[model samples]
Target: MTANSQMVTIKGTRDGLTLRLNDQCSFDSILEELYDKLSVNGVDDGQPMIRVTIQLGKRYLTMDQKEMLKRIIREKQKLVVEHIESDVITKEEAFAWKENSEITPIVRTIRSGQLIEVKGDLLLLGDVNPGGKVIATGNIFIIGHLRGIAHAGFDGNEEAVISASYMKPNQLRIAGQLSRAPDQDAEGVYIECGFIDKQDDAIRISPLQDVLKQKPDLVSFERRMLNG
Candidate 1:
């Protein structure tokens, strides 16, 4: 998750000190850096209360992660936890965020704690376990079971879709909208596809074959992303 390209920028403004983390970097890395940078020079009798505006680029932090970050600052360094901001953008991968020309594939199962982000379509050759996550700017096609978090259209592409042989994903997100698996059993649904319904402004799921038939020319996903 720590890449050489992960750029961190800091700036001071009237609002406060803004630590801008590259959207491509993982949350863990950002948090570690935050602790290292802020804790190095400050901390006087638990009373500095420096105002910090943390900006998350294109990613949402889990409640636990947020709490932990606040704890590190508020308790460890005695700094007041100020506003947390995120520049939520429609995205692809951090490195390939600007391009719309690639199709990424995973040859094996995405295990627990593994996170994947891609610029174009994603083809998973294996199952996605419960703790795994797949986020793409385009579409997601799962050859096996999809039992984890799958986010499509991270770049706000309304035409992006998600499909799987067995669609039991923990959660599904397209653009800014998100939905979770229903509480009921999914044994009856063998194959499924999820797509954004631009007219209704919602993500809809249907039988895979039926969805394909509706867009017979969609076999080439890159073409669709470019043309549709």
Candidate 2:
């Protein structure tokens, strides 16, 4: 019914209080309404501290504005700001997300001492010789032997995977987890995939066929073959 009420809606939940700020109103207006509401609903010194979650729907706030909002909530003393949520993101963030979601393809043999890095999923058509290293923010798929090191999800994406035709990498890493390949008498005949097990957070190596069961999302048949 009141302007302040329309500007900021406060609701109580089992966890704490949720503050839904009207995105349509100006930030200054919202701040004024918030201050008034906090002042009117004075808290008693004996009362327990209340956790507050602020939701800004479709509203983007700068770093200074976010800090100001947090400071205002903290000054209330009785209200502890748990976190702030927003549907809007900066252009840089959006670009990074898009870049990280893409798949990069390369055709070259990574020799010893060579390091290849990619922001997104990597599709390599050549072998990784001993002492060679490859890193990617997403998944890594190698059509050739991986004898050195392959680090997928280099930016801490645990869901990333590494698959190679010859699964004899010296070291394999998925996010923060790392595993060393055991001594093998011969190279692998079939492609092998490595991923982090969700249960124990350990790296596991399995046949590429098992990847269909483990990570069904990675399997796709969208590409069609063309006869010349």
Candidate 3:
């Protein structure tokens, strides 16, 4: 391929324009080619502002480099940056992503006054006795009873959910919403899940099976378990 083509690939999309930078090329080469290409065919002042999406495939750019890229594009006047995409991430970002995506499993029962917290999803193999508390930034799954306070999405993730085999929690909290188990006989309680009801923005309890319909991403956790 030509040097110009190898450095930067530009295409017109339905939304606007897409600029794909070659990951294998040096940043200087990319900048030179990109400047040349844009200078030759930059948008006209009379034309409407066009949204531009930059795709840096497997290429990592520093904040200054990103700003330079945006500045180069902005010089065209009629080109507005919609967003930037990249496949590469820093080690800290990778670690944070892993922490948020992975599920933490605990096999101990939480007694009264105990508190268990996890940065991500929590999978407890035992029960949470009354006065105990369980918290997770993501979803919470209890294989046994949950008679204590259970809070999922404690960091304000309204989409988080809490599920328990025996769903008689003293308090259920998803994000900022909170609800207490209804005052009823706990004789025939089965698997139950608690989530924030979008309609009312309140905590709602339903059969655990309903979670499949509400949050399909839960399937990924099941897949991880099966694969492991």
TM-score of 1: 0.51
Q: Where does candidate 2 stray beyond 4 Å?
A: 2-20, 29-55, 70-85, 182-188, 208-228
Which candidate would rank higher by TM-score, 1 or 2? 2
Q: Write the per-residue lDDT of candidate 1 for residues 105-198, one digit (tens) a residue.
A: 6799998899989887888889999999999988888888889999988988767788988888889998888877656666753778888666
Error of 2 at 139 (Å): 1.5
> Which stretches of candidate 3 lie above 4 Å from their native place?
1-55, 63-84, 182-187, 198-202
Model 2 Cα lDDT, one tens digit per residue, 161-193? 999888889899999999987676445468889
Clashes of 1: 3
Worst 10 residues of 3 by lDDT: 182-191
Candidate 1 differs from the real structure by a C-alpha RMSD in angstroms, to one decimal, of 13.9
Q: Write the per-residue lDDT of candidate 3 for residues 1-228, one digit (tens) a residue.
A: 675657888899999999999998799998998898888995667889999999999999998999999999888547888889999899999999788877899999999999999998899999999999999999999999999999999889998999998899999999888899877755665788998888887888888888779889888878867775
What are the RMSDs of all candidates, in order?
Answer: 13.9, 5.1, 4.7
Please tell me which model should have the higher lDDT, number 2 or number 3: 3
Better of 1 and 3 by TM-score: 3
